[model samples]
Target: MKLAAATPAAAQVKADELGQIPVLMYHRIMVKPQQSLDRSTTELYDELTRLAKDGYVPITAAQFVSGRIDVPAGKHPVVLTFDDSTPGHFGLDAQGNPKPDTAVGVIERVAHENPGFRPVATFYLNKDLFGMDELQAAAGLKWLVQHGYEVANHTMSHPDLSHLTKDQVHKEISGMEDEIVKMTGAHTTTFAYPFGVAPHKPAWAEKLDGSYAFQGIFLAGWRPSVSPFDGKFDRWAIDRVRSEGKVKEDDCKQFCSTAWLDYLDKHPDERYTSDGDPNTVTFPNVLEDRLAKPYRAWARVY
Candidate 1:
């Protein structure tokens, strides 16, 4: 019997020509489930394990928005996002480290176990920071930023933007940005609409000042997000699919993580694929002009 050969570093995997990426939306990670938003620890671990086995590399929201995906060659890019600052989402242990079983803890652990798995994620938080004690909230926010994870805005109190006045909208969006800056000394550039509802009257995206301007805004969609490289990509209204085990009241068709993963498996060409080089992006030649200005310099014809 012959022994199996070692995998080569330069071997290329089948790549997604259009650069379509998936931004998975997750809420609470709890041991004991409560409500539809809460997911169990076993489920969370299983999902991460599946992603690793399927060649899905985690990227931060900032990287996805900027079109600067720098994962290893042959790995697909995916964004793992946690909404709200619930206690089950994140917390500190007795030694002041990230507690295991929480979303952040589980993510970190997965990355540790999987050598090439990137330990990056974006947390859209409200006024509350992981529902930790008031004194620990600031430190926790700072810790997330220092560790390369993104800390983004989710409004001051998670109110429905569609129902609020312009002034009220300003307070809700800018208030959280101000609080985050004051606490962690980090500026937030991304926002996720509460309840997936955009403002009905004055558009929030158009009225934002330089201090609180958002580069990307996310919605709670039960579908995959378009590539930032695509001309139809909307930075102000980016779509995200929910991460759950079963379809709930608000979930759309193919809402769960497994369904979306299976969808990608069925249509591998629609998923984002690396050219094995971070310096270059590979896509169809016809879309050459559609590449963002920042990424055009290194865009390669597939």
Candidate 2:
């Protein structure tokens, strides 16, 4: 027998549209345990399975920043972001399908097993482009974009911009932009800080007139990000929780993906829940003040 739906969105689900969203940051997907940040193929699969069981759907970082969190009623939006264009993150097998051990591969597998778990993610790239040759790199990027995945700029070299001159910062970012366009023909609208920190002048990496502009800049932090429609949301320095189990560093016991996800599971009201209607933002009437002024016209208070 089916239990009754919780809250009231179409008499079907929870609709706290103003709640926090988990923007998970990943680094590498390798076989065997190597480091705290490294996750094996099975580990990746298990984590995603947990999310699917918890009524979460994957969306690209670009979509999150642009206020395009379109999902089913009662489903929460989660951004699965991978940094550094490593082969472990994406690659193809002899059959032209995503290799089963890569990040994309695991995502596809999980999505296949769990209905409505979109097999899409945002990958931040350095100039190496999966350490592949020019032709292979181009093919990989083309495949990702042709699908629903987002490919965004990291930099020419994943350098610490805080130590470089203003010109150097511009070169590092613009160089990757030029290369991305040259290879995949898709312009990136988002950026991830090389080390979760910005350039000394910040502006050098934020935008460049007519050449490069970003809808959002992400940081390697540990926390659920507020909705882009929230009045206090900061697109320039968006937070991303590292996709890892608990650790001693950075209060990971209370803040890493595992801890955060557990918290969200226990406290559903604090996380973003869709109203099944993409055109309008819906939430509890008490959160009306939290909605940004620009998004007022689309607001639906319950």
Candidate 3:
């Protein structure tokens, strides 16, 4: 419903009515989930299709934080968030059309097919991890923003915010914020914590908020606003149920399976809003799978 951010009435209604808004998180959208891949292409589409069929509205991170888009009484509102700027996300066609798998593609298709459902997406990108080179990446970033996606920060290098030194943390957050603003002319206010870690102290969270709009975190699960430890300040710190698997056949079923919902219900603590001075946490580098298709060659730098 295009909610205004500071309206007291809207905020109150959002708190009272919206049940746990399931924020669904995803990585790449490939037919095959890389060895380390959590979800295959079929699974991604299947989950989306089911969400459409089930009368789910895909709200952007902005809507989630603004408390707009009233959740129909007793309805579950969901936010679709994708992380990392991966090349594979630029979906290729049989004839070699370069269709980006950016959340825009998904939103547009959903809007077209489901007229009642308005689809918006939050794209969390690491300044250093873009699949394309500088210029192309800038173009791509601009395109995503132009098309109505909220480009939030994942950090300069997708490092664990809790692990870096305070200086490193500033670089990670401010550096990406500056790059994004320069490239797209959009001030990135929202940030997704690299690895979900509860802020050990309150100042860590305060520092982020003071630095930028710092809207929310996309961690795993379903959280209602009222519960203590509800992680609401992290309310901007939202939770997403992971959707990884093949979407075709039973894979789609698996993506939205009852089991997953049960899992989210059971693990409320896993949802992290902040940990203090995250720079103290050291993170290990892990390799994510890169696509090997010949079509990917088109995206290669000469």
Candidate 4:
């Protein structure tokens, strides 16, 4: 007797479930860093390899925020977010190419070697982009967006938003968006709070006259983020786990990569599994009543 093939709806139902996405955060990707935020190139590459081997696909923070994960079925989705516009994060060489040791270079190389792996990441940039020449910075920023990478705001000077006045907060947030538009001719819709400090008021995310707005705002986290499709999703206060080695001041519980990855290892059912098809949304029948508005309409209940 021949076995029946799975229909699209059945396949989607099988893929349907609430996914816990780990938005891995990184600072400077370099060797011999002066701060805890700095991660060595080898460490970076190793992490990327591990993610690829574990069937993780890199998606933009915007995509994750929009609840539109489009990775292949059976694969998990992860967002690689690089904070700060440091030289080591992303810069060009004398040949006008991505520096090999830079975050961009390493991601490009890793994706090239790993066929299904995508060389995409969200770079939360400040006014000073990689400390490159103005002309070079503009070209580089353009290149980043054109290559499927996201350029987002990390404030103009990485200020602590909690203490600033509303006007000051606007300057810190909208000012950076304006500058990014001027440099790259693109508008950034996402933001990351500097020093992991969120504003006291909701105005920080609102768009006033002549001020910019953000669809998603990130905070430093020691844990994985809930699926945007979950009822508990909070776009303004998204959490991200850091990708760094051991450090004294850092809280490894939910802030480090190993902790979260290990957590997922122990609780495999809580992890996000794609339906291998981007057009259809899938989730477990248990979460049928908790699906968000955007996904509720099309999501298949397994």
Query: Against the correct fold, how does model 4 do in TM-score?
Result: 0.92
* Predicted candidate 1 versus true structure: per-residue lDDT over 21-111, tens digit per residue: 8899988888988878778988888999889888889998988888777887778999999898788777778897889978889988998
Task: Please give the lDDT score for candidate 4.
Answer: 0.81
Output candidate 3 Cα RMSD: 15.3
Give me the candidate number with maximum TM-score: 2
For lDDT, the strongest prediction is 2
Write down the RMSD of all candidates, one decimal each. 6.0, 4.3, 15.3, 3.9
Clashing pairs in 4: 16-282, 16-283, 16-284, 17-283, 17-284, 72-276, 73-275, 73-276, 222-254, 222-255
Q: What's the CA error at residue 262 for candidate 2, in Å?
A: 0.3
* Alpha carbon lDDT of each predicted model: 0.79, 0.89, 0.52, 0.81
lDDT of 2 at 123: 95
Q: What's the distance in Å from true for residue 124, model 3?
A: 0.6
lDDT, residue 176, model 4: 85
Report the candidate with higher lDDT, 2 versus 4.
2
Which portions of model 3 miss their true places by more than 4 Å? 1-16, 70-76, 91-107, 198-202, 205-211, 221-233, 245-302
Give the per-residue lDDT digits (tens) of candidate 4, residues 1-302: 21223346546435644778999999887766676777898889999998898888999998888767888877889999999888888887889778998999999999988989989999998888898878888999998998999999998899888888988888877888888999877677788889878878865555656657678888887778988878888998898999864444577755589777877868767888887666555776666666677665567654
What are the runs in model 2 whose C-alpha is more than 4 Å off?
A: 1-12
Going through the candidates in order, what is the number of backbone clashes in each?
A: 0, 0, 24, 10
For candidate 2, the lDDT comes to 0.89
